[model samples]
Target: MWLLLALVLLLVILALEMLRFVRNMRTIPGPLPLPLLGNAHLFLGLTPAEACLRMGELAEKHGDTFGLFLGPSYSVMLFNPRDVERVLSSTQLLTKSEEYSFLGRWLNEGLLVSNGRKWHRRRKIITPAFHFRILEQYVEIFDRQSLRLVEELKLRRSRGHAGVNLGEAIHLCTLDAICETAMGVSLNAQTNVDSEYVQAVKTISMVLHKRMFNILYRFDLTYMLTPLARAEKKALNVLHQFTEKIIVQRREELIRSGKEQEASTKEDVDDVGAKRKMAFLDILLQSTIDERPLNNLDIREEVDTFMFEGHDTTSSALMFFFYNIATHPEAQQKCFEEVMSVVGQDKSTPVTYELLNKLHYVDLCVKETLRMYPSVPLLGRKVLEDCEINGKLIPAGTNIGISPLYLGRREELFSEPNSFKPERFDVVTTAEKLNPYAYIPFSAGPRNCIGQKFAMLEIKAIVANVLRHYAVDFVGDTSKPPVLIAELILRTKDPLMFKLRERVY
Candidate 1:
């Protein structure tokens, strides 16, 4: 009788809580959700691309702002620029949503996932690593890796393939560049794309994506029971071991050279081959927060974070850029001509930061590519306190999603939003001013990407080198575009195919 009375009381409390949640969310227009399941059934077993499309369909059916229950979590997605600005611009709304917790195993409390005081401190420590002088030195690494990419593509074509998936090639190249720049070591991912380290990264990413959508796999206890958990564990071991090894090796090297002290005080350091550059690892190894030097674990988290963000996002941008320019021959010819004229006709010539800056037309095309396929399709934040966004009361504890993918395609924001028109970003010549919040490929406001300049420089280097060597053309049916999936970073369901012909100067 006592146990039965306790069970009844627990049930009553749950009912009251559910009723309060319903009262708060019902005012927000959205699809009528099923009890307990909420709107999860709509996304059940859907691919990331299909799920993204479903969200888009819902946005069209409802208005700019809508609500949904993702498992037990109530989320409100904001599409309008006003609502986006309110959330992104606020200092208090900096905490990442619960979904980011899934990355905790791989990234830990790095700059990407940390919040409040910790985020602020980490951000400060990492800021100097991207100093203009430091980024300028990384241009050499970009030039070298991008040339390697061109060589790899040529070698593949010589092997008698009619067309190759240019995306895979780009991925390997970016991975190589990031490893060198982030950790002061080379995985030679371009050469060994099938290495254990590479495969581990891929596996972890796949597992994380599936876990986000699968309700049963969301909890730690239940997730560990599944087969994916084993794969994830193996991958984590490989990744953690790799990063920890690099961190130890880098720290030891720095200490041995006695330049470790210099790195802490100065923005630059003497790297291998007499190159004056500081890899992010060097800075972290020497950095002190509150007068205490960062330990190995802290350093590894940031280095791992840098490795993931620095490579994948830039690789995504390049892949889509290649696809877009290949499909538009006029744009391709213009970009090629710009590279040849500004950087020189010699395909072997190294592209300098100055030359990359001179390729104004290519810059326009890169911006346009990001606009069409922003590397990060969705930006999410958890509301810490009750807030009013565009006259709507957004209750605390609500997960807020802002989709750059859909935001960039709004008819009101861009005329013919679907077309690949580089001229649209010609701010100097065009009279129509763009709303800053509407097109946030790199995002905007306080939590914007810190490595945007580094990414831009690397992208331009690839464009200059690749276009200097070959004339690229998309191989697939133009009408049937590759299915896009947003897995942390945006990617196609399959690698994008392209034909690369050596340019006759």
Candidate 2:
């Protein structure tokens, strides 16, 4: 009887091993993974992006696409440009990965992360909000606050210091831009970091970013399993309470305005400003598809999703932008020339759309930076049905990973893929070009970033304004760039520091 019981246990273990890789699955090909843990052991000393790069190198040698099982998190990573193009463009058989389980807790069914009908509806509803006419109206609002940073650094560089840490400053500028355009709130964080709302926004965002990777958060039975989870809960609670308070205040303000309107017109109707606090809330608050109205919690989810994705991606691009420009004085000088050429040696005047448009080289510089260090490091999807890629069978639940970071840097793709070269974007015709997928900083296909135009506009304005005022230089170690750490996006592990020098020109 004891022998029979042992036999049954052994059979169970064997069954689990068999399920690791479906042999009938076309097997794009990948390094063999250990049981239960799969390829997780490969990530022992690497960030997720670094690990993906390492895996990508292995895949290039072995095959264009390959499968990896990190625990039950199985996904085929597309290493070749061809494979990535197919997976990203063909959304029918592939859907967003289940790995985003953590991010989903806050997003609900927001446009950026939701699926199918809900995603379609939200996308349709929010499309009008970002219409060029509406977004163009906010560019001046972006420029107004960007000057605050240039002014702050002006004071810091008077003593012959190298540079001020610009990460937080840039974040402030973007925060103000997003706030004013979306929520109709006014904040100039470039000049003041101590603002209650700014601090709360930053703290809560930091806490959320820090929570996604805590393995202990995965366990339900263990309270003492991870202190990180507890801290995250506290942060989330505070953020929700804070957001609700703001929502309530906006509601009351709207109510009073509504009452005044009713008294004046002698008729009843919802307050235009009161019905929605800002564009961020307005997108969801005013949404309806065939009479399916979004609830307040639904509104909360969408607002938070926009708030997070809005500042984070732009901040990543800007940080890398400054770091790149600071290191390459030639590039920075060229950018200044480009800006001055457009603005005509003007220092006192603020940048406008026409002026921003004139800096074509600067636009190329931004594109090149994004190609090398894309804001979103890794994009993932899951196989909804058994699918074939590059003549290989990819099974369902397989997480397909692709990185613009690697594709953009491949020697086979770009001339000097690793080198900083803005001229790569100077091609006059779209036909005479590299695979568009090879340089997707804002991703590609139907689900690419909706706010990309808004982000680029803000970035160009800020860069032009900063150069018009001051020239950036590295104070300490220009020899070593910030080590890349992959979270929701690629971030510098340390605060990217450099010295700022006032341009005597």
Candidate 3:
């Protein structure tokens, strides 16, 4: 009789938990979720790329805002710009979603994932690194690397451009550029494609993306039992070790040069009107928060964060830029003409920071491409306090997803939203008429991307250099678009193919 009573009590407890879960979900409209598993089964047997597309489809059917469950966690996805603005613009809602905690093993408390006072302090310390004068100095690096990329492509052109994986080649170029600017170390990732550091970065991202969609891997013990988890551990060791080595080396170099003291005092700049030789890592080494200096582990987190953000995001945007230019011949020719006008007929002439500003058409094209294919398809924020969206109550602890991918393509926000018309970004007429929150490729608000200016300069520099010499054409089936996957950053499911032809001036 006592045993029977215990079983009844256990069943009653579970029944109450179920009732509470159902009550919490009843306020929000979404696809019906199954017991225990929730909506996780939607991703079964689907690749990340396919899953991304399916998510977008669900958003389309469910309207602007809807709730879903990833395991037991109740979350809402916001597709409307107004809803997104409300969540992103709030100072109190600064905490990132639980999904980002998955990256803590790699990124720790870096700016990308940190919250509250820590994030505020780090943001202040790192802001100076991307200053105009410093980015002006980076232009020389961008121009030189772009020239190297041109040379590499010329070599690959010998094999014909029919099946050339331009995306992979561009990724290498961006990786090399970021390593130099961010770490002050040359990995030469473009030329040395077999570098362990480069390979490890690639592997870690793949492992993390797979883990994200697989609900079973959410628990540490369950994940550890999987082969992918072992692979992730190996890749992480390689990545963490690489960053730690660079941080130590950079600190030692700064002390030897006696610039460590100067870097700590003020913005590091030379008397000759040129920026100092300091990189992002150097700034982090010299930075402190509330009288506390960052330890080696803290430094490593920021360095790894910058390296991942700087390279992967820019490369994804560039790949889409190349695709857009290839498909639209008229826009490509206009862009080429504009680049030639500013850069002149000499293909060997280096693109300067000033010259980059004058390529108006090229800038428009880059903006248009970004709008069409944002590198980060969605931004996840965990609600810190109870919030109301369009008269609906969203309780605290709910994960809210803001999708630039869906918002950018909304017909209400953009006229002819699916069309790749660069003219829409024209500064004078149409651009001023649009809403700021509606077109957030780099996002908006105080937490908007600090590296946006640097990204723009890099994109313009590389695209201009390529268009100065080569005219790109789509070699694949033009009817079919490349399958897009949203990991931490957006990516193509397959290689982005383009035919490059040398232009005779």
Overall lDDT per candidate, in order of appearance: 0.85, 0.69, 0.82
1-505 per-residue lDDT for model 1 (tens digits) = 8657755664464455445457766667877766666678898888888987999999999999998876657789999998898888888899999898998999999888999999999998788788766887789999999998988998888774769888888989999999999888889998897899999989988898878767778766558778999999999999999989988888888788987666554433323213666677877887888878899889888988898888889999999999999999999999998898997777778888788889899999999999889999988999888888878888888889999989888989988899999998998886657789998988887888989999999999998999988999998889866798876789988778889888897
Per-residue lDDT of model 3, residues 1-505, tens digit only: 8657755664464454445446666677777766655676777788888888888888888888888877546789988877888877888788989888888888989999999998998898888778777788888888989888988888888875365677888899999899888888888988889999889988988777766667767755457778988888888899898889988888888789886666564434333115466577877787777756688998999888888788989999999999998988999989988988898998888898899999898888898888889998888888878888778788877888888887888888888888898889997756546777888889888789989999999999999988887889878878877778877788888778877888897
Q: Give stretches of model 3 more than 4 Å off.
A: 1-21, 267-275
Instruction: Please give the distance, in angstroms, between residue 331's alpha carbon in candidate 2 and its true position after superposition.
Output: 2.1
Of the two candidates 1 and 2, the one with more favorable lDDT, higher being better, is 1
Ranking by lDDT: 1, 3, 2
Candidate 1: Cα lDDT at 50: 92
TM-score of each: 0.94, 0.85, 0.93
Give residue 375's lDDT in candidate 1 (0 to 100): 96
Which is the winner by lDDT between candidate 2 and candidate 3? 3
Residue 274 in candidate 1, Cα distance off native in Å = 10
Model 1, position 176, has a per-residue lDDT of 93
Compare the candidates by lDDT and give the number of the best one: 1
Taking all chains together, the TM-score of candidate 1 against the true structure is 0.94
User: Candidate 3, after superposition: displacement of residue 275 in Å?
Assistant: 4.9
